[model samples]
Target: MAGELAGHAGDAANHGIDLIPIVALLAAAAIAVPIFKRLGLGSVLGYLAAGLLLGPSGIALIADPSSVLAASELGVVLFLFIIGLEMEPSKLWALRKQIFGLGVIQVGLCGALLTGVGILLGFAPVVAFVFGMGFVLTSTAIVMQILGERGELNSPSGQKMVSVLLLEDLAIVPLLGVVALLAPHEEISLTTRLISVGVAVGAIVLLIFLGRRIMNPFFGILSRAKVREVMTAGALLVVLGAGLLFQLSGLSMAMGAFMAGVLLSTSTFRHQLEADVEPFRGLLLGLFFLAVGMSLDLGIVGENWQIIALSVVAYMLVKAVAIYVIARVLKSDHAEALERAVLMGQGGEFAFVLYTTAVTAGIIDGPTNAIFTATVIVSMVLTPFAIIAMQKLMPKRVQPLDGVELADGLNGSVLMIGFGRFGQIASQSLLGKGHKVSIIDNDVEMIQAAQPFGFKIYYGDGTRLDVLHAAGAGNADLVLVCVNKKGDATKIAQLLRHEFPLVKVMVRSYDRGHAIELREIGVDFELRETFESALQFGAHAIRVMGADEIEIEEMIEGVRVRDRARFEAQVLGGVTAGTGLLLSNAEDQARESGIAPTVKLVAAEEKEERAN
Candidate 1:
């Protein structure tokens, strides 16, 4: 009886311990992500920190890193799937040249440079080549996550980066073949290579066919079933299934998922698939980062610190320089080239696979693999900081104004200082009324793009006094400072007031506080950029919620009056001074008022307006 009781207790304790890891992971992520984000370090670093804390190198909260890494890889697969969903076949076709041409050249150049560095570090030629090539494969997760967070994934530069990443993914197969060929003991015959290549090609064709033919019908059936969970399950099934197919064929799981996404990009179910997989993708991706953090073998790093540090610095510097030079040579601007270089400098998760394969094939030793792996991790850790440094240190590049007309001596009644969306809209009414409006902008690309659309915008930095005068700001009856940056707008407004005192300055305010600041500075007219639009939006929302049109209009007017009063109070005192003008839905406050809510609210607002 005593033995049985002890056994049961032990079983209960073991089960409870299993839950500890899950709790620790959640708590660490919850605590760390917000704190890091608040510090401007970003969520990726937070996850990594959490992993490091929990891993054997820290507190050993999670003893097994490999299991976590294996499981978390699904996050990468889902991430690729979502990326593919955004890339339509048309876009992929459009990017073919960049993907193949730029991608291949970048890889070849970076790989060669990195390999030379490895050889100088005392590795044999073949081992150095493996090391170099491994580092050339940039971390897709890190780059993509950063790009997504910054909302740059759809930009031209962002698309180019994505193209390079795609090429890297495809290169993994051939890279593996190279590894096989380089294996000293293993005899890889020409016939075997041909067979492997044929298999990979056939698998790709089969996947494309099945994705085109079967996936939509399969999703259609799942949707018709009318079960939300089942639809989600089906989406996961497709992602995982596609990933598994590629993994078996010795290609990247991410590539398979990407291919799956591209095929379904034109499907009606693409959005639904993306929505279903997003939550999983986020959670898993976080887990993946944590696993990578945990995988940093502190013991190996401590012993091989000097060599590891040297390798990381040398590899990253070489890779970065190569990337920057190649990008510049390929017609990328200095800023774009530098950004790409910094972002793609670090070795990626794929490096682990290459390193491990090399070990298995007698190409490198176990200790060397561990040191190299640690080097990659450290590089990954430094990437966010590197990006931050690059942004702070790098000056904004001014594009060549080859064919763009400079804002030279001109005369017009209205000198519009910016030609952004706001300025474009503001100029329409002035131009429609046959008013002479001179438009000037510093963005050469925007000017060129707008030229075909009949916008006669000239290139000029509105913040500069000379540029303003050259753009006819001195002679204009009214000067419109419609630039988006508050600092620029403020500078222009101040400059106009000090120099062109006779000219009326109408400025676009970024927000309510900005509007108040502009008013305090004594601009002739200042409008909060989104104020009218927000009011219209609120009214439309009330209308949609079944309010009478008259009631909606009354509410809108009331809001406007109250807003004006609040703004005046805030300007006189501070932002907190207008709290009394705000509406309250509390029953106690309503009872204290002793009048119908609507009447009392309007009366209070009107009274506030009058007092102001």
Candidate 2:
């Protein structure tokens, strides 16, 4: 009877759902995320580290990783939804050349090369093809998160990376179909396959058309209702509904979610929807990455460490070289091309999906699938380190200034130091008003590039007084410090204020602290680089939410005036700018400006109540 009871308990433990692993996973994340972020390794790596600690290979605390992974797949779906929401249809259309052109060539060539490698390793042709296709994909979640964190998503290199990843996502459907054909599964007729494809296309079109028609009104009502929970639920429903529609029609759920996002991108509710779903997307995606770490098979890795290492090195080398060649062919500069190659050299999350599909379809046996999965995981685990290494190895290249000479009497009323994006904008605006502008920058490449645009930029470090004198800073009416670095800006501002005291200095600051430092150095005209842009964005958002234009403009102006006053007051008083001080000053300013103090008080009270 005791033995029978123990056996029954064992059965119960096996069959019954347990919450311990879930608790453990959350606890691991709670501890790991902050620590990793503090160490500057990022939260994705933190999740991976947490998973590694609690996984079967570590303490064996999580008995069933597949269950955790299954639940975490929702993160990927939501991630794709957010990505879609951020992208407009027109933008996607604009990227069509890169998406189809560079993306297609990268996959085709990478797939072929990896397949050849697999064949030489003694795998059958079908298995080699599966391996090649699976390995051609780089980790979209990891790459995007890293790049987005660095604020490079819209940069040239970032765009190229995104274009390639987009194509890979689209290519999954066809790749799966190919795997199905290669396997000994029950054969469907060619006509039926074609019909399936057509149906999938029709479903996508129907989704976009119907979504565009209904989503705007639906979100409008939700926004007017002003129930945050209801709005959040509505957002989730839209994403899941679209994802399910696509899944039922034999397309990727993520693909469907992306389509839904594009349809809603132009809606006024876009920002609200993004705000509602961002927290969920972030948490779930972290969980997804944690699940990936848990899925790594340490036993297999231990047994085949040498082969796994060789495979990973070979895979990255091959993909990196291929991607570099492709980027150059697509007109990318050497630095941008190398960055793309390094950023995209790892196997992606979809490898797990594809490998499972192949195994289930009997195209690849269990052992081969295990090896391939292990290889992919190892490559992904090393990707962040690879990115860091590549960045360190490939410093930004500055063009040579050989044979370049500044024009004689290069004196202008406006002396613009730094010919980067910020400097260019300020210079162009002044020039548009018919001001004579002389530009100076340390980046020789930038000066060379700007020459074709009729900009006569002198290559020199503006912080050096010799370079400034050579550029005729003494006779200039105003000196605009538009350098990229805060320290450099401050340095040039000090030099001008001390040496050329008569020349007015207008400096661009990176942030609040930098602005304060500039003010301390007696630069009267200082502009925070992104401050006005952010305020303008906020104004537009308020307008979209039904604020009157006149009222919005007045409110913006009042806030700006008050902020400037408060900043000056804090600097003069030698008080550090903290949240409490900021709020107190804002309330005082609002009262003085005859704004509604009750509204501000109520908002603050509500926020405190929510925190409680």
Candidate 3:
């Protein structure tokens, strides 16, 4: 009776103590999140910092890292699951060679080499295996976080990383399965395990075939309901149902979620679904990371600081160097390769879980486990510094095309170029607000489309100045270049700088590197045409039940804030600038500047609606 009472007391004590870490983590994260956002950094970085601060080895606020790591592992799982949900068979096949082949070779090569070093350092073979595999796994959390922040979550590199990360995440399941098969510690038969895997795969294939056939019709039925609430509920059912089905098949929940996502991807409403689920995904992901932060073990760190530090140094050096070499060999640009290396140099969250599991399973000893765990955590913490270091090491300068004009116009303060869908909207919006918008487009079709709209849309290459003069461009206040192509955007920006030196040019870019190129050429203001605002608004609207006007207004405000922030952050992070300077300078220049095109969108709509 006395022993039972003591056991109950011990359980309660541990539970109470566990809550301390959770509280501390949340407090720190709450403080850090907004501060980082104001500085234009991301929330993931903030969570990592919170982890470090709460870590027993650091501030000692949260001491039981084992428990923390175990819980935090779910964030990674859910992240991967969401990723799988995003991919379909056709898309999956397209990336198979890269994900399986390139990802396999990369992980294998990196792991083996790292393991060889561990062996030389006097660790056992099993220890080396654990260390090697753990180190080779890069952080999906960090990768996704960075992509989300930069609004490049759908870029080519982003897509490639998603494919690679998903394969790597899936590969973890097999690694454990294969290990268990090689050395059976459990009562389950090897044949049974094999059958389980086979069954999982077969079931997935069958569902995919059947789901594709039924999903369209299912969604069609919901659409006919003419009820948004019912449609949304039905959509959720499809996603959740498919996910649950995969889980029952002895596969990872993420794998199931991914298959469901893929099945849904075949639908015409794939983008809409992605749009629908994104808010839930983000909030869930944030909560997941918060949980991870709360799980850090402070006690372990205090006792093993030296070990953690050494392991972290070794892992970062090896992984970053290996990734840099691989990227260079793959023929990435010098700067791009360097950025890729630095960005992906950390040990992934999966490594932490794997290391802990292996240690518990007796596949690796305590010291080796410490080394792997500490290394991964430290590498993750150092990501921001690593990016800064890479930026310094591999600064890329954009060279404008030769013979591009430096200064040409004296009258036009703003030169609007490339008037297509984006351009027409821009011009109309600007005109609605009574801002003089000088329109230009290379496409004759665009000019023809604009002709009937009762706007004098000019037809010209925009590369030529005489044509620009005929359109009253010299008297314009600002240049809003909404061109689609990267090369053309660059050319026009450069040409304008040569010809219209006094006019402050606000240009649209393809992406970050493209903006960097424009910056190097000294474009006054550049905005990367990120698709995230739309995705972000859509996600928030569908999930949060945000009203239509509220959502539209949010998009407009978000667009302005995002554009303003991008402009300010880039310049501050470069040209030897600061955030205050960027903002003050931009505002001072645009103080007399009138309302933006987006500001007049409502009026334009009302006018057109009345006319119709």
Candidate 4:
């Protein structure tokens, strides 16, 4: 009876729903992410540290990483789904030359180069294949992390990284299919494998078509029931259920997650669902990184440091050379070629999965497997260093001079830094009001995108004094730094203020605190995107509450003194609307009080005229 009871308990534990892992991940991230953020590192690295501390290898608070792994697969799916949504057909088509042509060349050349190196080191063809494919992928997390930190995520280099990543993402599936073939599964012919793939793909298409017709409506009704637990439960069910279907259907759970993301990517409620799923995704991905850390196998490292060291060296040198050669072939400058080469010449998250699968397939013996794992992990561990190295190595390329380009256009105009969403809006608003505006950006793609839409955008970084002059900043009446990054925005504001002392500066800040910093930097105007959205949302709510337009306007004015250029003490301080509201309210009150004075003066004048 006791044995039976133990069996039942074990079964329940294995299959029963538990949310502790999710909760713990959140708590850990909440504590660690902000601390790391304050330290000028990144939230992701902090989360990685948190995972290492909480995972089985550390305190073991998150003992079973299986659940986290399962959830992480979904995160990747959603992430890819969003990528697909962002990449419309036209954009993808335009990128065919890069995505397919250049992408194939890079992947093929790198794989062949890496494979030759791997085999020469005595790896079986299967192990070499996995190693080569895995090494070909750069760390998306690391590259994006660095880009985000420097506010360079939208730069020309950044966009190139995106295109490269997208191509790698597409390549990952076929690489897995190749690995499956190397495995010692029951004797399946080549035709059988191809047929299986065709069938699986067909089924996926059918399921997706069915899902688009049925999934949203089903979710809508479920949501309307207003049960918080049900919604969370349903989300988990979707992830697991879809993952199970994928596995049973002879594909990876990760692949299933990816397909699920693709379907949801086109959904009308993508943002809302994404927001809801984010916490789960983040925790799982964090734990996944932690798992990678735990899998480091310090014992193996100690015993085989020599082999690991050589592998790591060969890995970086070969990959870097490959990328460097490719960049040069593409006609990239010396600086750009080196930067891309350094940033990408390392293994990534997918390496772990590929290596493990290859080993399970008898393609690698025990010792070879250990070395392979170590090499990948070392590559990951070296990424932050690589980024730092790249930063140090990245030169100014060309020195900043008095005038880089001739002031071809009219020199006197409003310098509009950034040509993306916010900047474009600003330029139009100013232009519609008859103010001359000159737009600038560092992204060639964004410049091209904006130009076709009739935007007056030029390619250049706002921080560069040369770009500023080229944008007619010297003679501009005012300068608007509408770039989205706090650092970049602040940097531009400082540059303009220092170089063109007479150019009035206005900056677009991300938040209230950011706006304060901009104001401290003497920015003539600071507009926070969220503040405007919040104001609009609040105004809509007031209208819904039956507030008249005049009353609503007055109330909005009151709110404004809480945010805008107002010296009203009440708005700026304790238990009241901020400075913006008070200034607007005071103005409204003064107008109200002036009514009686005007009426009495008018009546006295009429009386005097009648008396005369």
Provide the overall lDDT of each model, using Cα atoms, as 2-decimal numbers: 0.87, 0.80, 0.63, 0.66
lDDT of 2 by residue, 252-326 (tens): 787888888889877766656876887888888888888888888899998988778878888888888999998
Worst ten in a row by lDDT for model 2: 574-583
Q: How do these models rank on lDDT, best leading?
A: 1, 2, 4, 3
lDDT tens digits, residues 411-430, model 3? 43345788776666656666
At residue 450, candidate 4 shows an lDDT of 61
- Of candidate 3, the 10-residue stretch with the lowest lDDT total is 399-408
TM-score each candidate.
0.67, 0.66, 0.61, 0.61
How does residue 50 of candidate 2 score in lDDT? 88
- Candidate 1 regions with alpha-carbon error over 4 angstroms: 1-13, 396-612
Q: Residue pairs in steric clash, candidate 1?
A: none
| Ranking of all candidate structures by their TM-score, best first | 1, 2, 3, 4
Residues 270-381 of candidate 4: C-alpha lDDT, one tens digit per residue:
4445545656765555565655554555567779998788778888889889988997898887777788888788787767667767777767677877777778877876
**Which candidate has the top score in lDDT?**
1
Question: Model 3, which residues run further than 4 Å from truth?
Answer: 1-30, 51-92, 182-190, 220-250, 365-371, 403-612
Candidate 1 lDDT at 94 equals 96
Q: Write the per-residue lDDT of candidate 1 for residues 1-612, one digit (tens) a residue.
A: 334534654576778754557777888889999999899898889999999988888877677898999899889889999999979899899999999999999999899888899999999899899999998999999999887765556667988999999999899888988898889877878898788778778889988998889999999788778898999999999999989888888889999999999999877676678879989999999999999999988888899999999999999999999899999999998899999999999999889888898998889998888888899999998898899899889975454576788888979999998889899899989999999999999888889998898889888877666677788888999999899988678767766876688899999999987787677667999999999999999899989999998999889888888889999987755567677677766545667888545434545656698999
Those runs of model 4 whose alpha carbons end farther than 4 Å from true positions after fitting are: 1-39, 50-73, 144-156, 183-186, 215-247, 252-266, 397-612
